[model samples]
Target: MEKRVVFDGKLLPYALLMPQLLITIIFFYWPAAQAVWQSFFIQDAFGLTMQFVWFENYSVLFANPDYYRSMVTTLVFSCLVTFFSLSIALMFAVQADKHIKAAGAYKTFLMWPYAVAPAIAGVLWLFMFQPSLGLVAQAIRALGVDWNPQLNGGHAMTLVVMAATWKQISYNFLFFLAGLQSIPKSVIEAAAIDGARPARRFWTIIFPLLSPTTFFLLVVNIVYVFFDTFGIIDSVTGGGPAQATTTLVYKVFSDGRLGGDLGGSAAQSVILMILVIGLTAIQFRYIERKVQY
Candidate 1:
């Protein structure tokens, strides 16, 4: 009973696919190829000179202690962001799924952060955690705790992680809410009739049904932490406080755009791209096995 669209002609199919093919080539493949090519070369301070030292840039990058530190920072940031964003969003979605009064307004408030730009989100958090004039920062200091993100590396990392996690929560909430709504109520009712507690029903029945959605969000959250958090980190901390919040993506921008190390930056970009691709592959290979559907 499955009907398929049959192409009338080969040329017509090719013509229809041309636009997407051109875009992928021009935007993705071309830049990736250019980065790979440039990673092997050394460009001087001026645009006039170029030295082709194969693998020297990558070798120097690996030897640099700052690069390894940035890697560690990125790993920690990604883990924290992914965990907090997904878990918090799931919690909110669960609450909002209930038939509470003014539920629409509550859901709307929770979802509003997704519409805000990442830079704007970071700035908003920065204003509240400014350490000097910030309301939250003042309250924290009043608690007899020294709170200064500007001078403390750990504080700076915490600030960026909070901003990034907040920015992503709304996105994850949307998906989790949708996943929850898609589950059959009859299944939950049956579980309840079987004397299953609310928490047990959620974990054993509802959550298993949502495995596909959870798996998809896991991949998306990882990618978001890797690349999309650049704006938040840049606007809020600018990878400051001794590079505590300097992720791989931020390092690429800082080293190339600000430090003017084009070759090294390209190498970093290449490595970052490879790392993300490998992580995604590993997730699909191993993690996906646990997903019910």
Candidate 2:
């Protein structure tokens, strides 16, 4: 009787969690485990031949010049997108938090971009930057500057970063606005009573309280830029101008889809997973600690 009761009690909580646990195992954990396993070997003979290579894929990847360049491009793209998106989101959030009229309308308008699909966003940007038909391109030419991604690697990268950052900013802004609203109004009033200037109050009180939101958004934005926005790269630059915009994720896609290098692609996926996990761990260990409750 005692054993039966204990078993039933233990099973109840686990039964309640079974659906989510199964979904995680099926969708996330299984694929991840497979990718890690396959990274150590190469497939041949139409999936009939398998040999344990033990870091050969990684060795070749690190030795390849194109891989190194892709890694660098990915890092730079993630950093620039995260920084610009978070900064602009913070600015907009602060403005939207005020008692100014039309704040709701402004926020709605700003958030419209976030609703657009990333692939569509990329196509829209492409149209806006077309050298002959693009409005911005025409303006740049009028300023005696030739803005051609086809001819300039740096220009291509700039276009990709700008497109990705534009899509990310609205999402970050939503989080930041929520964080701002959640802050206790009394804290700001107390700072004002202390004769603190508006800028000082913001820097000393508002910014600190917003740190938790900022940290959360930072991690999310970084991961999104790293993994999810490949559509922007595909539509805007196509990793073009001599592979300047070819990021790690883009390389993985190209290798798997175009190059027929499944094992290599799997290796890249594993590396990317490791990189994200390592960065997230570091953020939780150090950055999250600094965030105010």
Candidate 3:
């Protein structure tokens, strides 16, 4: 027989959930509702007049070529950031998981970057890669490559991608390390006893067990690249070298706050929200199938 615990007091459960529910309503739902409502109307630059233009803002947004460019930029940026951040973090986690000296200090140093603010992280990278004065830029130029991110679109995109990847790696590393630690040592020992090499053991035994963690990190990294990378793009490139690094979220900021196209920005935000939801749903539906747990 299976044993079960029953909660006789229904109000207790509701009471426990109230705070979180309220917070979600206030922060997420309210803002989302506002964005949706505002998407249908156009606000003037002077804030003195408004026009009710249902779907016009969205139509104009869709027709804009730069918007499509931003979408492409966003897709590429998200893919690169997600791939490098997860893969490199996993690599580091694997190495750090070994019985090495000063392991605590090693992990502490690895995790320190996660505590840095995104804008601050971007600024730090910017200072290290600034074409005229940055240390990394100087070194790259010394290698005979024309290293000018300010004038080169490709270089600007690369810079933002590097900064974004660097910002996210520490977060992924923390989770990967936790997942590595959680795997039972007995199972690993059993695999080793079977004459399995270290790489074979990791790919065949360890990796399969880490699927759940990897899947979770994949979702988080996608979300991070789509939304959380705004600060990095802003502080580093301001979405430039001719809008080379202008991702969807950054475009939203550039349009609304900077360009003063509030309605169109809101529409972009709605579309972005929908796109992320669709991606997450697809991941959960298809990708989750491969997860061991």
Clashes of each: 0, 0, 0
Give a tens-digit lDDT track for model 2, residues 1-101: 45553454678899999999999999999999998888888886267888889999888888899998898999899999999999998999999999999
User: Could you give candidate 3's per-residue lDDT for residues 1-293 as a string of tens digits?
Assistant: 99999999789999999999999999999999999999999997677888899999999988999999999999999999999999999999999999999999999999988988999999999999998889999999999999999989999988998988998899999999999999999999998999999999999989999999999999999999999989988999999989899999999999999999899999999999999999999999999998998
lDDT of 1 by residue, 1-293 (tens): 99998878799889999999999999999999999998998896565778899999999999999999999999999999999999999999999999999999999999999999999999999999998889999999999989999889999989999999998999999999999999999999998999999999989998899899989999999999999999999999999988888899999999899988889999999999999999999999999999998
Each model's C-alpha lDDT?
Answer: 0.93, 0.90, 0.94
Off by over 4 Å in 2: 1-8, 44-51
Model 2 lDDT at residue 38: 82
lDDT, candidate 1, residue 253?
A: 97
Off by over 4 Å in 1: 1-5
lDDT of 1 at 46: 68
Question: In model 1, what are the clashing residue pairs, if there are any?
Answer: none
lDDT of 3 at 222: 98
* lDDT, residue 22, candidate 1: 100
Task: Give per-model TM-scores.
Answer: 0.96, 0.94, 0.96
